[model samples]
Target: MRFLLVEDNAELGDAVVAWLSMEGHAVDHALTLAEAHDWLAVAEYDLMLLDVMLPDGDGRSFLRETRTAERLPVIVLTARSQVADRVDTLDLGADDYLTKPFDFAELEARCRAVLRRRGTPAPVVIPLGSALFDPSSGTLTQDGESQRLRNRELRLLEVFARNKGQILSKSHLLDRLFSQDAEVTENAIEVYVGRLRRRLQQAGVQIETVRGVGYRMTAP
Candidate 1:
């Protein structure tokens, strides 16, 4: 997934970016609202980790303005820990709020929760034959065995499961699978698709190629 981190604290920014990147996500750090706007103009992001205070402007204002146009999921990261502060931020359209000096694990869990709530609603657990697919955690389990999926592979499966039967062109897959700044080739999609195909074979699912077009997920 691609994320935009709008923050000014150098130490915190570096740690957050490093942590998320290690999980195979593309992350962009913007120290100011001006830079955040620039990033938004250039690329799309699945989520935004925003700081309430910035060098140039208040992130709350940016969040308010952003709400007027897009439904970008935002989690406000700030030093304000008061109950009223959380309520006010939520009132301003923040999806979640994290107090400063937070554990990275909790932060990640909140991020996942916010995304699951904001995303196009998918089944909590989708059954593919004997395997159970959990979209929230991006895990596939069968009996007592769980398939460990790579980041890209998991994302590809999620897309297919959501759009199930609809034809997805290679270009569309490319856009969905990679960040705008990623140096990827169309062949990369084919590679991931192949990997997912093998994994899903036992789950009673098939990825059908649409000839000159792209691919679709089908079930017997």
Candidate 2:
């Protein structure tokens, strides 16, 4: 999923970005509220990891201003862990809250939980034509036979299923599958698409490519 991280401290921001990237999330880092607003204006993000303190303005004010229209899930990260602070952020429509010096694993888990809560509950077996994709086990089955997919393949399929019928560009797919540090080329995306297409075809599932644009996975 795409995440916007709003933080002011350079060192802390870099560390959080690196950690989230390693966890296979597409993260955009913003050091100030102005920068965060700029990103929110142009891009779509699944969640916002907001730091309450900023150089020019407080993140709480920013949340209050954009909360109505954006309606995007937000997780407030702040050093002020007082009860009042928590109450204030929650009142401002934050979906979750995390204190500073938090564990990265816990943060990742919270992000996943928030996103899951925002999305429809995935079925145990997703049926597409004669094939069934098992979300729980990340396995694809056809005619009672099952095939295990690599982590990246499973993730790609999950993204496709989650946003079924949407044309996702190659760059967006790469951002979803690999971290910023992972070396990815246009050809790399093509290679993975080829492999995924062959596997799905073997299972009698159809994934359509929008020539020169991207790909879409249709539901049965």
Candidate 3:
């Protein structure tokens, strides 16, 4: 999962980022509201950990501005513990709230809870025939054995696994396989698909190419 951490406290921000990354997540940190907004403009994120205080503006204000348009889940990280503060943050659009001096374990749990509420949390392990795909760490195992995958291959497989049994257009696959800034051709998508099909076949999952359409995952 990808998360954006908007925090001004260097120690706390570094700890949180390190913890989440160790647990197999991609994280971006911003020290100010403006920097956070800049990151949000170009990349996709699953959840955001926002701090209430910033150098340029209040995080609450930023939340209010984005509440109507943003779809990613948000958890407010602040030192305020008053009932009214929590209530107001929730009312403004925070999916959850965390006070300062929090344990990393609890923070991870809250992150999962918010994602679950949005119905976007990935399973710990995806079982396909005799294969197992752990989306968190992007690990694949087959018949009690683990399979090594390149970064791109793992990402491509994740996209296919999440939308299993559905036809994914070439354009859609291309977009999902690469970041917004990546420039990959449509034909390049075919090469990745072909590689995935051969390797996954060993684990009993077939990625079938639909005639002149796209690709679908099915049991062999």
TM-score on alpha carbons, each prediction: 0.81, 0.79, 0.70
Clashing pairs in 3: none
Give the alpha carbon lDDT tens digit for every residue of 1-220 in model 2: 6788999999988998888765556688898999988888877788899999899998999889878787788999999979999998999989999999899989988887887787736436777668888865778888889998765677778788777779999888887766444567877778877877888886556678889988888756
Each model's lDDT: 0.85, 0.81, 0.83
| Ranking, TM-score, top scorer first | 1, 2, 3
How good is model 2 by TM-score? Answer: 0.79
lDDT of candidate 3 over 140-194, digit per residue (tens): 8886778777666776788788888999999777655543434558888888888
Which structure is stronger by TM-score: 2 or 3? 2
Task: Report the Cα RMSD per candidate.
Answer: 2.9, 3.3, 4.7
Query: Model 3: runs farther than 4 Å from truth?
Result: 121-125, 134-141, 144-157, 164-201, 205-219
By summed lDDT, which 10 consecutive residues of candidate 1 come out lowest? Answer: 120-129
Better structure of 1 and 2 per lDDT: 1
Best-matching candidate per TM-score = 1
Better of 2 and 3 by lDDT: 3
Q: State each candidate's clash count.
A: 0, 0, 0
